[model samples]
Target: MRKTIALFVLTLVICSCVSATPIAVAEGEADRFESWNETDFLKDFVSNNLDRTVATAGEEKAGDYVLSVLEKMGYTTRKDNGLTSAKQRFDYVDSINGDANVGYNIVARKDVSGATEFVIIGCHYDNLTSYELNGEKVGGEGAGEATGVAVMLKLAYDLRYETLPFNVVFVAFGGNQLGLYGAEKFIGANQSIVDNTLLMLNLDSVGVGDYLYMYADEVSTKHEDFVYDLSEKLNLDVRKPPKDKKIVAAKIRDDSKLPYHHKGLLSENSLFLDYGVNTLNLFGYNWTGEGYGGESENHPDIVGTKRDTLSNYLAYYSESGQKKMETATALVKAAVTAEDFSAVMKESKKEKFDYSWLVSDKVRIGVSLGILAVLAAAAALVYVKLDKIQKNSKKAEDKSDDFQKQSEKVFEDF
Candidate 1:
């Protein structure tokens, strides 16, 4: 009996040691993410839901589809009826005959054990109903809009079971086309969530553009840098807006007075910046265009136009669109599941100095003119001083000649 008891104690000790061994850290590396096949889903989504204009049946159907997708993935879903009380504040609401209940933001949350911080993944699902462009009433094709939501959904599906250091919240905002009403409402309602959020990644127009770019507010520079580095590791082509173009664009919009304008895009991401939250906006826009804005004539003509149809997008930019979606998904996955997310969160809170003014044409032109004026004045002063010296030297030479003649006359007279 004594021998049996000793053996049982030894077995217990061995089991405890084995169980106490720490598991390997969860590093959301590039190798872990493979190429995602979302082409079928993207094509189908855009085909079925073509006109997702705000306060319309099409928009409601799109919202329901998003909720169903999340529910099918075993996620508990909820709705935040954004800014119900202040419906009168928006002029578009009246124009569209939209009431307080028009835009409802669909929210799905995944909680991690013992996690204090949260990461928000958001995108708007609404597009223009029908707008007259070039004397033709065109349906809203919404290829870019569909692509943004598709990437968000794909991320949710991919990261559903992963062990992340922070909780994840996915939001599909409504009434975005109607002036960012849904995003504003969500921000107002979820103050606590916004307060503790480590990063809010906003995906907008990730398809049918010439480039895949990322933008972040000034406070979230670390997050931007980290994601850009990760993209390089993944062999993805992710870029930021050109410094000179962004400066010119910001100057045209008169965004100089806004403190965080340089760091952010004019999208739903701007709403989060208002609450001092770190935000990264993954957007596909044509920065190679000679025109100033993303939607200039030189850029791809999609988003709110007839050509935004999936068929058109696929016909023209199918390969580039797929690559953009894949890059966005991989980068977001790597970022959210990063082992050093806590460190990133801490670093992202520290705001960086804004250097946008350095590249601004207004500032550049002013400094250039100032420099030329100074140079011209210096040249004039130098020329005047040299002229005075030359005149004095000539006078001195004449006096020397006169003295030599006087000495010669005195010697001859002696």
Candidate 2:
């Protein structure tokens, strides 16, 4: 029975495998997400705000920038002395250099289902800070860091409209370049909450708008396969993570217990592994992690540095491909698939399903089976009837002949 079910699942998988081209429907078909565009609200948001990512830790303006975006997306805002809202909160990491210095983590979630499963997707919004040097603010802004924030914004906006498989918390963390302070605080305060999380995807930098990069291990292949497969179908430039980084996951090894932040640590992200969730953490880079999922539209050298500027974040990065936008969309679609966005769409919007072709293939397969079965049954029945008729006819002929012979012999004798 299990084998039969597995075969059926395999058949369904083949039938549902995402195609190179989006499915074509007759006129007036419901819009299936062929190209899941990530440029909805966040792109606009990030393009405008990349400069602020380099602001000092606990910068009110930087925190507010993220806050405004969340509020626009319909989330209630909360603020504490060391916190802002559920989405934006404060933390002090002394090791990273701070008193009760302020840093914010903006968090928000869409309540799709009960908290049976929880997936946390996050990115650091704070970039490398500008330290005062020689009475002048030395080059402010971390290289590659602003791009990370921009990508996070884009992701946050994308998730706002998406129907998620589980309750997805979008966290905008601060202080990654500075000893992972922001991430540590968030994870530490919410260790139990983090533990309950099913999956976590950390998008550090997503789009130079050229190619896609995925970071994962063998355990993440199921999720990674979806991305790679989609990339193949789209013929896009999709790259993999470096060898050392691949082993990193949702939990890590510590003195006694596995720390939250290790190659396999839930310290910050990779929550997706808990619930079999798939995820990726992209960073802005030049040649290696170039393009959309690799590097955002930011200069890699200035990332995690104060020298980072808006110019560092806005140039459209393109490699030889279809139009940059088209390629970017393709990569986004692939990530969404690996992220299980399609499932969310299908399950959440079940009412919108197209009933026309819902069972068309099944009906067609059934028709073929039915026709062959009927033909075989008819052939067998016909052969049996013909055989019986032939035998009966021979018996009658033999009996009649015998009678005639006997009668003739008796007449002759008499």
Candidate 3:
């Protein structure tokens, strides 16, 4: 009886310890970002074949690679060659249009279920004149501009199986280094898409710095507050300069300021901003110059140099890549799940409950105790049954021994 009780207690203790462990759910969704490795594609983008220069054979190779990937992922891809129209509309398009070879804008479109609107995400794939360590202009292929392309490709792969509420269009703009010609051409050709675009998120050079910078001019959509709120929700160190200030293009020595209402002065998101489409230009580098009361060197230098290869920036790639992935994930989640930016930002302000804590020690202990009680009762029932069987077996053994002795005594008397 004492042994049965001890065995029952031991069973209860074993069951209690097992119950306290975290439960694994077989139906949980897999993480999409984990499978999307940025460096593997980055290597291909920076290879010698995809030289990414203006009107070069290498540029065509890069465009072909992008198109192939989009097709493999089951996206409807198209090319936008609006440079002829760009030349007719703007006087500044003369320099870039000199080359008879047309610059192609690779666009991949995916329609979401019940989506009434479209979200255009873009990045420039063209690289400017490569510079040396001493700031000397050199003639070579460019890899600095490839980072944005790599990021966009990763986003497309991660969101391939996702069903969002808004149509998503991923664009790789050519001739971006010449000017914002590719963006201008896209806007010129896709008038209908521009009109219904819910937001335009531009990814440019997101491989360098620790900080994530989002730029919007005065004419851009009123998305500063929403972006700030979203960044806080995702825990990204974001820097968004004021509209009245000039910081975005100061390091590059361009007129990429907020009051860029002029067609000649354009960033990648210029036309979208001009047409009142909500635009967010996500860059990892921050420029600190006279406009922001500091020197340009105070900020981390941007790509566009020969040294801006994958090997050079590979050290911090994981950190910057994680931030970009998190930002994209949060933005897409909010866009797909929310009715408007206001609702998204408002929800970010609410106190979010961490359901992960449910499996922590405190809750686990309570659950373990309940499970232990039930297991103890079951163990007690099992012990009583086994104890009765043992006693009955002993009684049967004694009866057999007595029968054998009686038979032997009868045989001896005979």
Candidate 4:
């Protein structure tokens, strides 16, 4: 019995000390994007489009291209036109027309048998009409957004045949430049999906930046840390938002007291974070630089400008951009395919209770004034009652004294 108890204790210790092993990727896995002709696809996709502004012909063409690619990959593909099967509309107001417009969110899915959860990978394919930078107007080619779409496509194609533990859904969101309309529509139409989502990985502007940055919802950092660890293993230079005054000021300025608002960059991931979903956003930007530019030498701030063309990206920063994409794909692939993904997800799933109402200055001030008013009323009522009692007691004592004096006077008269 003593030996058995000792052995049981030893087993418990071993179990307690042993951590879950994350998925491992071979070094060559990072190069799969190049090997599988995904880089060529990226170049072609970006080159063929002038700009994918929402509600335009270019946007429609881009959406069609995404659908065709997914269909060829042997996956189930559909277009979510910001509408629910129940006929509910999740459309957004067009900035130009001021009319309701449906942003086509291209959704492609690969299902695994017995999988109850989903891993969503998303990217915005829309670009701004134009951006005025340094007093010069420039057209928006949106190379960064295109890069994200290409990365998502590569991931979809690579994972097409694999039997993942969870269902993988790839989304190319539309009208992201105007607003996060596409992402919002997706969440609104798929309430059930929101509940079953394990993780939402967002790739935005992941190439052509100075450095690769990873941002996660404030609810938990486990997913972010896991990807960061993967980056380290792969010898990729991945960074988190620095705690600098500029970054902090930006966060504060954009603070809506929402989960995603606390993060540095805002994208379609914001909507997912708002829904309390565990989201990982991989963006390529230099947090240390001004105006979304990278800190690296010659890293131009070309994201929203005409200079964001594929040619410029290739000519200046192709090597670094490709490396960043490779790193992002490898890290994301490893994370979603990790052997202990469920375990990691369980740890990352934290209930992010919004206490903003309780912490709001308006609510606090209102509540404080309400309590003060109640206390003041109670104090005044108590004071009035005490004063009445004191006066009544004094009157009774005076009456007693008068009665005694009258009785003494009557006795003297007698």
Top candidate on TM-score is 4
Candidate 1 structure quality by residue, lDDT tens digits, 159-200: 777877777888888767645666766766676778889899
Q: Per-residue lDDT for 211-297 in model 3, tens only?
A: 556775443233556666766876766677534444233211122223223211234776565555667776654344434322123
Best by lDDT: 4
- Give a tens-digit lDDT track for model 4, residues 1-414: 000000000010100111112123234543544466445657867776666766676775677666655555554323232111111123566443355565577777776667788888998887754433366655567775578888898888777766677777788887676556677677767767778898899998788667888888553377677777877887778887776514332221122444223333467776677667788888777677664335355765677666777777777667888888888888888777778887777677764445367447898699899999999999999999999999999999999999999999999999
lDDT of each: 0.65, 0.45, 0.54, 0.66
Model 4 scores worst on lDDT over the 10 consecutive residues at 1-10
TM-score, candidate number 1 = 0.67
Alpha-carbon shift of residue 330 in model 4 (angstroms) = 0.4
Candidate 3 residue runs with Cα over 4 Å from true position: 1-34, 48-50, 76-97, 113-116, 129-141, 219-222, 242-244, 247-266, 289-302, 315-318, 321-336, 339-414
Q: Per-residue error at 233 for model 3, in Å?
A: 1.9
Ranking by TM-score: 4, 1, 3, 2
TM-score of each: 0.67, 0.53, 0.60, 0.71
Better of 1 and 3 by lDDT: 1
